[model samples]
Structures are given as C-alpha cells and as structure tokens.
Target: LFRWDGVRDVHIWLWETGIDFSSVIASFNCGTNTFAKNHLFRRLRWLGHRAASHLATLGYLAIWHGYHLGYFVLFLFEFGCVVAQEQLYALIDRTPGWAEFNAKPIVRPFVWLFGRLTINYAMGSTFMTMGLLKTKYWIGVSVRSINMFTILGCNSTIKSAFYVLT
Candidate 1:
C-alpha cells in the first residue's frame, strides 16, 4: 500500500506537471534522454529511504551510547524525509485540494501552484531536516544539529529571495 501510494504520488506529480508518464516511460517521449537523469530526484526520494532509515537507526544507537555524533541530526532528517515522503504522498492524495479547485475554477492556477510548491516543500523539508537528529548528550545536544534544525530554512530563503527580487 505504501509503495502504491508513493508511486501514485509520483504519477500525480508527473500528471500535475502536464507530463505523460506512458509516453515518457515507453521512450516515445524520450523525456530528454532517460528516466534516471530526469527522474533522479524522485527516484532518490524513493530509493534512498531505506538507506536513510538504516543510517538514522545506527546513528541513534551510536549517539545513545555517547559519541562524537556530529551527523546525527542529518541522519534524522534523512529518515524523516523517508517517512514524510510516504506520509505527504498519502496526505496529498487523499486531500480535498482538488475539490476546492474544481469548485472555484477561476483559482485553479493558484491552486495548482500552491499544490506544487507545497509538494516541493514537503520534499525539501525532509531533505533539509537530515541535519538535526545528530548524536545526543545526557544534558544537551552538540552544536552540530543547529544546521539541521531549520529544515524549512531553504523554503523561507527561496521565498524571501523571490519576494526581494520581485
């Protein structure tokens, strides 16, 4: 079910972006060469999940044992990406965003962009969070996790840059 949901999310992403999956997959569309190069990010989001979770568990154990733990937060974020990707895919799939858009056709474009950017934030947030789950301390965490704590930092930066430029 999870795998299906993830694949469905990818399908929706492709569809919402106005791309045809069959043509791209069948080589009739080429997709600018191949799926690997063009879909690496989506594939990474799916494939790297297992490795990321394993890394998080190991890092958690190591930190729990009292160690250098510099990358613990990053490990956590990676794990979170794995989980969040699964969750957000499910959530967006089941959401009524489409219903709202259909009810207000004039705002369909805004809804489309909102959904797209929200989906991107979901991905980027998970990736950026990889920096926070660093090794732990009995009293307090090390400064290493600071870099990972603000997982949405990139989105904010992008928004601000766009606002400033616009």
Candidate 2:
C-alpha cells in the first residue's frame, strides 16, 4: 500500500472518534478520541485495523497476481516497516527531547534527510520488486538501511522515555 494509506487511516480514526458508531462499524467506535488519547489501546486498535486490511488486500493481490509467495513476504515486511514508522512517530510526538532535537538548526536537516533515505531504502523492495526471489534479493541488499530505522524502535533509551511518558 501507499504511504497515503497511513495518513488516510489517521484521518479515519480521527473522524471515527468524533462521529457516532452507528455511522461506522458494527459497534467498535474507533474514533473515541478521549477514550484512548495517545494511549497504547488506541495504537493497538489502529494496528489491528491496519493488519486486517493489509491481510485482506494481500490475499487479493496474491490471487490476482498468480499467487506468488512474494506477495505474502512483501506484506509481512511492509507491516513491520509501517509499525516501526508508527512507533517512531509516537516517540517523536511524545518525547520532548526528540522535539527539541528535531528543531535544531543543523541536526534537523540531517535527521530528516537520513530518516527519509532510510525509509525509502527500507520500502524500496516492497514497492519496486516482485515475486519472492526478487523481493528477497532487494531486501537483502537494503537490509542495513532498514535495520537503522528498526533500531530506533528497539533502542532502550527511546522506549524507556516513550513508555514513561505514556
């Protein structure tokens, strides 16, 4: 899926929280902003929705594209990348230090550029390559870049700070 899918999801969650459930899902009112403002529960629900939809879409692609194992692999890696990105977003949003770091005149540009390059490199395989073999090859080539972004999600300092705030 495109990056806009994530933006659309945030909008949907915000919209759903504000409106009535009757105007949405069976009984799951995802838009209850106050109920889950900046909480793990909210993030979990978003991940659930994201995974469910991606699973369905991947299944459709597998069927439509001749049932390649690569489709599943791509979806799996893509899911991890998306989750990592979400965690980073949450970390940056909640961490005052990160906000300060992001605002630095010299540091800001470097971080932004590095972050974008790492993300693009991580996602390149999923977006450009097809079939299990080709996807695997591209991912192997780009794994280093992907690891850097993933490391941000796993770093103890980042997690401790992020969790403490929440």
Candidate 3:
C-alpha cells in the first residue's frame, strides 16, 4: 500500500501550507554549507568528510535555533539518524547477497513496512522533543527513547543469534 508516491503527497501538503518548513531548513542548510566550504573545510581537512560535515551543519543549525538544550538534542538526534541511515545503506551494499535478498519481491513489502515504522517512530520522538522546549522533560524523553532503541537492538541481536544456533 505504501509507496514512494506517498512522499510526493506529503510534499504537496507542505507546499499548500504556505509556510513551508522545508524552505527554512533548506536556507539553514545552504548557510551551513557555505560556511563549511569557506571556513571549516579550508581549515580542517578532516571535517570535510561527509559525516563530519553533517555533524557540523546540524550543530550550526542547533546553535542558530536558540540557547535551548532541546534544540541541540533535536538536531543531534537528526544527525544520528542521517548517519545511521547512511551506514545502513552502505552495509546493505557491501554485504554479499544481502542487497539482492532485500530487493526480492517477496521481501520488499516487509522491508517497506519496517522502514516506514522506524521513520515514523523517529519522527514522533523528534516532534515530541520539538514540542517540549524544557530541558528536563526533553532530556528524559530522549534518554527513554535511546534506552528503547538499545533494548530493541539487543532483542534483534538475540533473535539473530538464536536463529543461527537453530
């Protein structure tokens, strides 16, 4: 049921809103990119790497937003998501037979469902943090969310191990 075309619907809705959050984000991204290219990348070659550049850009956005700790937490969480996504794609590409397995018609729906659920969970957590500007509450939520992810990761690992043994 879920398809990439649904993303276009989301974009259309956002455009209809008149106040497009994406444009704001894009402006910030452009500013960060220019600064990174002119100042940061020139001074530090290591920071020119993709991950580091994303970190720097997100950090800049966090600071630009305000002095609120929640802002920093939100952007950091976003940066982590971006990094995780890149790593996941890279791993899928590098693992022998994994890419083909994931691409198989029978497996595609499950993959789409998993990806959508994960993205929705992340977005919900992020929006919750965004709404709660107070440091104490947002920190508690962030820590709890991190713990949940950790537990989920451990469960997946255990399940995989059991499958291997069986």
Candidate 4:
C-alpha cells in the first residue's frame, strides 16, 4: 500500500501544480544522495529541504485522498521519524566508534530489525486509516509506540556520540 504512494506520484503532482520538481524530488527521491554530499551546512540545508518536501507530499496526498485529518496526522508522524532517522544516521556516520560498534556481527541484526520495524510503524497508520475519525483515533493510539521507539533511538544515538567523544 505504501509502495503505491511513490515519490514519482509526488513529483507528477508538483509538476501539475506548477511547483519546482527539482527542489522537492531531490530530497524525497534521492534522500541518501543528498545526505551523503559533503558540505559544511549539508545537514542544516537537508533538514529544511526535507521538511518542505514532506509537507508538500503530505498535502498532495491529503488532497488526493479527500483532505482528511489522518493525512495531516500521518504527515506529522512521518516528518518526525524522518528527521530523527537523519540525525541518527548523521551521528552514526560521524562517530567512527559508534559506527563500528553497530556494525559488529552480533549487533548488526538487531539494529536492522529495529530499523525495519520503526519504519513500518511510522508508515502503518497511513495505510490503515481511512476516515478522519479513524485516522485521528488510530494515530493517537499508535503514535505512542512510534514516539517511544524514536526517543529510544535518539537517546542511544546521543549516548553513543557522547561516549565516542569522551
């Protein structure tokens, strides 16, 4: 279901609506590429670009699906997840010790599993909810788990950064 909501669709929508496809699609379609580029302010610029691109896609999706509250709520949820993941990935990249720690044979599987689950949980609401009431209620209920996982990930990342620095 989420697979059907492709970045290509978002690009087409933005094109139809007279917006610059390059700006939004750059982050939305090639996120890792943008994230990997070397520049002093890359992270800061990517964050802003990501926010705008996500919001634009969410708005288009909401309108496409009849402008329900679920779309908005799901947008908020996804935005948080993407930002958190970006920060964590950046931290893991910058801290060689943390990166090596996570890459160990005994630890890598757990990290992979957790990452898959977190991404699915972040997107599950959009696929599950239909109407405004159901969307709002479901988001309210499910967001607790999403947020918990996010907090846990962020705490671990921050701690790893601190440990590596010290």
Clashing pairs in 3: none
lDDT of 3 by residue, 95-143 (tens): 9999999889999878766765676666566667767887776677667
lDDT of each: 0.42, 0.50, 0.60, 0.52
Clashing pairs in 1: 72-133, 72-134, 73-131, 73-132, 73-133, 73-134, 74-130, 74-131, 77-129, 77-130
Superposition-based RMSD of candidate 3 using all C-alpha atoms, in angstroms: 10.2
Model 4 misplaced regions, further than 4 Å: 1-50, 124-126, 130-140, 143-166
Instruction: Give model 1's TM-score versus the native structure.
Output: 0.27
Tens-place lDDT per residue, model 4, 35-66, is: 33332234335546545555555555556556
Ranking according to lDDT, highest score first: 3, 4, 2, 1
- What is the per-residue lDDT of model 2 for residues 1-166, given as tens digits with 9 covering 90 to 100? 6455434324454333322212222222334323333443334555456445444444554455555556665555544544555566788889878878777898866775666565455555555445345555656644664466557664443344334333
Better candidate by lDDT, 1 or 4: 4
* TM-score attained by model 3: 0.63
Q: Point out where model 2 deviates above 4 Å.
A: 1-50, 127-166
What does the lDDT come to for candidate 2?
0.50
Task: Provide the global lDDT of candidate 4 against the true structure.
Answer: 0.52
- Give TM-scores for every candidate, taking all chains together and pairing residue i with residue i: 0.27, 0.45, 0.63, 0.50
Which scores higher on TM-score, 1 or 4? 4
